[model samples]
Target: MADKSSSNAYWAANVRIILISLVIWFTCSFGFGILLRPMLSGISVGGTDLGFWFAQQGSILVFLVLIFFYAWKMGKIDAEHGVDE
Candidate 1:
């Protein structure tokens, strides 16, 4: 019973991390790239709007960083639960 509860807690934490990561991914890619582009247009990057950068490159970079961050964080979590691969 105790082991089952511990496993449930670990899985819950993993799911929470994934959900938060997805939210950030959506906000950066869709929110800033498209929906909020106009609001960010005032900020210039190489004579182009920051929105364009975010739409094109910024979000990709952010996603890559998030991938690494998630991997590292999850590794720590797995180790904490003694289930690391």
Candidate 2:
């Protein structure tokens, strides 16, 4: 019925958001910090190579930002689905 479809849509949206966030976190922490380090070496941040900065600090900062983003996004999603408190 319509309610079941709405529930499915809500869950689908939620999962999509989770997947996107995880991809960003993984790309920042692992892809930039390790896989792309050599390519980013030419760039400098705070007296260190960009890659090192990502490994040491950038990823953590990105995670915190993502946390806030996820919360804000989910709030909107919840409201749309009539699930917000």
Candidate 3:
């Protein structure tokens, strides 16, 4: 019973984390990178709009940040839930 409850909690926690991470990912990628391209048109980088950088390089950098953040957060989450392994 305890194990099952813990498992359920772990799933719920992970799901919440993933959903939050994806929302941030999408916002940073499609929102600033594409959807709001016109708004960011004034900013340029090496003969390219900032949005272009966001779509290509910026998103990848954000992804790496998210990855490390997720790893750190998940580690804390795992320890909190007693599921670290």
**Steric overlap count per candidate:** 0, 0, 0
* lDDT of the structure predicted as candidate 2: 0.92
Query: Which segments of model 1 are wrong by more than 4 Å?
Result: none
Q: Write the per-residue lDDT of candidate 1 for residues 12-85, one digit (tens) a residue.
A: 98999999999999999998999999999999999899889999999999999999999999999898887876
Q: In angstroms, how far off is 85's CA in candidate 2?
A: 2.0
Superposition TM-score, candidate 1 onto the true structure = 0.93
Error of 3 at 66 (Å): 0.6
- The TM-scores, one per candidate, come to 0.93, 0.92, 0.81
Question: Who is ahead in lDDT, 1 or 3?
Answer: 1
lDDT of 3: 0.89
The TM-score of candidate 2 is 0.92
Candidate 3, poorest ten consecutive residues by summed lDDT: 1-10
**Highest-scoring model, lDDT:** 2
C-alpha lDDT values of all predictions: 0.91, 0.92, 0.89
Candidate 3 error regions (>4 Å) = none
How much is 1 displaced in model 1, in angstroms?
A: 12
C-alpha lDDT of residue 76 in model 1: 90
Predicted model with the maximum TM-score: 1
